[model samples]
Target: MKITEQEVHSVAEIARLELTQEEGQKITHALQVILEQTEALKRLEISKVKPTVYVLPLQNVFSEDQLDKCLTQEQALGNAPEVEKGCFKVPRII
Candidate 1:
């Protein structure tokens, strides 16, 4: 499918994009190519293929979360430039 200049301009307006005439032409051509490729892909034979989310094999590789010895308040705030009531203190924000 070919994307027209007017169609590109309307799409850009809806998307709030500011495209020059040259940019609009480039985008239109790219969109047309993408549409053609998608249409060609629709003709592929996949009757026996399963509709899977991932193209490759998937596996979980994460380790179980474990807690370690944590720092004391004084040790945690020791590097702060300012400390008050055993905690780091900073300028107030609205």
Candidate 2:
């Protein structure tokens, strides 16, 4: 699982990154370490462990939805800096 200098350069090109020689070497070494660590983890035995989606149980904490009255059009538009034809107006994009 050794990462090579060429591989690092290839990845840098794909990402449109400009890496100095020292930075490229450092990245290659770091990638090698990560791959080695992942390989080590793959050797661990966890056959008896149960699969879990979350580390802790999750519950909905929000209150139930209730019908509510909304503001009228004039009330909603009252704070607008600019309004036209009963709606907010802004500069044309095109």
Scored by CA lDDT, what does every candidate get?
A: 0.89, 0.90
lDDT tens string, model 1, 25-87?
Answer: 999998998888899867999898889898779778687799888999978998999999987
Per-model C-alpha RMSD: 8.4, 8.1
User: In model 1, which residue pairs have backbone atoms overlapping below 3 Å?
Assistant: none
lDDT of 2 by residue, 35-86 (tens): 9889996688978888877887877768778988999999999999999999
TM-scores of the models, in the order given: 0.46, 0.47
Model 2 steric clash pairs: none
Error of 2 at 94 (Å): 25
| Clashes within 3 Å, all models in order | 0, 0
Task: Report how far off residue 40 is in candidate 1 (Å).
Answer: 1.2
Clashes of 2: 0
Which stretches of candidate 2 lie above 4 Å from their native place?
Answer: 46-94
